[model samples]
Target: MADRTSKKPPTTRKTSLYRLTDDGDPDLRSLIRPRYLDQEGFRARPVRQGPLRGLLVTGTTAPGPADWCQALADLTGLAVNEENHTAFGLLIVRTEKHIYALGHGMGHLMIEPARIDPGFGIHFAVRCLEKDRVTKVRRQIMDARGRSDENSVTSGEHIRGFGIEEFGEIVSHIAGKVRGIPLTYTGGDAAGAHITGNDRSVKLRLGRTPEDLMNDLLAIEEVCERDDPLPEFDFITQVRPLEAVSDLAQGLDARLDEMLGTGVPGRVGLAVPSECREGFDSAETFRVRVARRTRTVPELDAQTLLGPVSSCAPGERLETLRKGKVQMFADSDAEEVISGNVSAGRWLTAEVVEEGAHYFLWQGKWYEVGAEYLATVKRRVTELLARPSRITLPPWPKGEGEGPYNEKRVAARAGYVLLDKKNVHTARLHGGGWEVCDLLGPDGQLIHIKKAPSGTAPLNHLFAQARMCVETLKYDTGARRKFIAKLDEIAPGHPARDFREPTVVLGILLKEGEPVTADSLFSFAQISLLHTDNVLKGLGARLEVVSIGR
Candidate 1:
């Protein structure tokens, strides 16, 4: 269980920590924008249940497969038939300001807006003025691929003639020789553009959380207001028509294949020369160089750049130092302290990166070789912090989004009465909110629980929420009075915990399993504790961190 009483960022202190989830909506679920998957079959379609379509489907339930069934029906006002080729739908994403959806080059917002069918293709070619005198761009690609004419330069709907991974570099190489077009927008006749590139090799979809979408629009609006007070971009974020989703998908596929390599799915093999300029001949050093040897080395450790991809084959493995002879088995190999002793020619299925050396993913964690060679490892005391392995990420709830909900219920059943929903006050940040103490006991016990699906509570965010809630209550006089009155009615003469008095809350979320994780929570807890002492001390409150099990 991870619990913290950390201080908030400086900005959180000055303004209201809680914003209404919407302009005036009480239900907070409206803030979620789910990710869409691209599995084959019905799941591949961008609409029906996909965020890729850009339709803001309104529903309370975390949008799941079944839930999407009803949402689609509601959106179309007609039956949804995946089998119906003629059955079509369009989904668009837009914020309140862009309710009318206008702006400069709003077309870029959507992956594509035209011909929402499978036949669409993204032609990833340099869009150039015929007079740029750089027809060599196409000619060069054709010559390299041993092609004759422009038609021969492309494959099917894609320009398979050129290396997809080199697209960015190619554009840069010819940037000066060609002019870039402004993608056609009013007040911005952005024309005379150089090479244009879009790929339709793989069905790709882009997703943005509502918060992210809001941030982008807010940033755009801020710039516009500073210059053009009556900015037309207020309508910028609204989803508009462009190309087809299929084209974007293809482009995405072609690009990923280029990066991940067609070798053996997830596993990549590198050969190191026994000779080096410097005397540094360690396998770890050599491996690092190869990974960085590519122009994409800056983005090494592939997973970060790969995005959501197929997991490596089960038991998949990669050997950064495989089939290579070694000087001798040492207590520590390279800069890493080995578990025991590894012999020469023994490939390291699990290795880590360190100070120009591989040292156990920085102390404790370890990543396995194979397809997952590039996975980041977050471990504490040799125990791996788990990632969400669920097929779908559950919808983040609107309330506190904390475990204290379950904790409160368990305690309530165990005889500690908690505040009812109406009496439960929250300080909401329109995006999310947190609850102070779910239930205060007659014994002056204030409880705040954190929910952790992986059995490790996330302390930082929870602490921020808890701090915001308590501070909001403390500063908001009417709210503070109302809470006290409610407490008086709920626990008459029970020595209720008072906001103006030194108070105590049992943070009963952490449970010491067979392997204790409290130490893992140490860093965050220290910061949170310092914050509570400095900030919450005036509120006459302090939280006691403890753990309990079901």
Candidate 2:
């Protein structure tokens, strides 16, 4: 590929140059963000050793060396030698607004570091295997292309510098996508493997390879542990579908409305603005969709960075914003649901962590919940604690721009209708830091819930949330007004007036399929069950493990 622009940057300079140069090039910033000290006003200065060394953030208020060094240590979780100036070969220093990093071979984070365009670099990928099967394949490819020297030193277990070739009869079913690029790497070195291609040259490599390129395609796709024929319940217990509980609530709500006729109130409903209230039809009152930035899910914005809800989308059920499985519903209504039950159609993360799991070794703490499911549960619990509105997944899918895909690159790509919920919102008392509970229940009862298999961490997290909800309600009596107001809006006719209070019945929907009780997940998570009962009893709320299987 030819270098198009003639404007060349100055060499042997400070970090400021990279920032200035990067502003005109968004791609440069993207490449630098993951590896270097960016945006924080880094300046380049000469160092005693290494190529064009010395990097630092510039500004009076910039964080200092202690902070940057600590950040580096935290990032890698490795100790650093401040005096030696060598850890990751990095001499990291930070002032008020300036931070500097310079290491041997140029650590790829500098503004216009050296000898690299790094344009998403070549997607070189090679797998490390104990065998040399790729050698014959590479030999065949070289012969076909009339090339030689298959064992070239520069092509050390890398995806680049190799012609795309057939993956052999064992894996010949694959299709090639990158035009004019081979899809296989048959290196001679059985001791090493890699999948790397530099962006410096498109002639070398381009586009993505199949994800499981090295997954011993010779074997059956599933050689072990397929879903048991007895039931999906055990697996469901291990991986609780977070959406399933909401679905049950919604399903129950829908069933109740249908059974009781016209205006008969149900346990679930949404509280949107009176004007937007019409969107919540009698049948659709079990509003499942909420804002993308709702409290239950992870908040993406920096200001709203209460916690992380990093999505592993296109997940088990093929649920992802990309797959159109996530629900980003259209709401020209509110920022979040003021008070309501989450519905079935809404997008929610699936719970994969069994109850009472721990990571005391990695976390270095006693009884820490260590599963992705629990992490998600914590966020959802936060949402429930906030008493949000019903949220839809695939939030109003916009074109390829603001939404899943935008092959055409439309004008409103990534566009979303920000309903004016900020205007008609209600008071949601924020609780202190807490973990996720599985259940998201009505406002009047014990709020926030989670399902835990046989473990103490999840149960602890659940109990803590139940305790917090009790405390919040006890402290914030006026919180009930918001709850009452939501009931008035959704239930109508003041039917909730007959409802009781203080004894909010928070349900932890168990994976206990009917006719099976003793071996239920709740039993496994019973390590802290009695303690949880004692806590909730003392705090003044009810906790019930209500199982509704699929």
> What are the runs in model 1 whose C-alpha is more than 4 Å off?
1-415, 423-434, 453-457, 504-518, 522-534
- lDDT, model 1: 0.30
Worst 10 residues of 1 by lDDT: 12-21
Model 1 lDDT tens row, 1-550: 5555575422111110011112343222232222222212212121223222223222121223454566798898987634312211112334444321111121112223222221111111222223223222222110011122222222122223332221101121211112332221111334332232122111111113344334433433333234221121111111111222334433432333343333323322111111210121211321222222212121113232222222333222122211112221112333442122222112111122233322111011121112111111113211222211111111223343344454444444533556524344433333222244555554555555454322111343344445555676667665666666776776555665456653444343432321224343332232233344344555666545444333
The per-residue C-alpha lDDT of model 1 at residue 202 equals: 12
Question: Which is the leading candidate under TM-score?
Answer: 1
- As a whole number from 0 to 100, the lDDT of residue 531 in candidate 2 is 37
**TM-score: model 2 vs. ground truth:** 0.23
- Return the lDDT, model 1, position 299: 13
TM-score per prediction, in order, is: 0.27, 0.23
lDDT of each: 0.30, 0.27
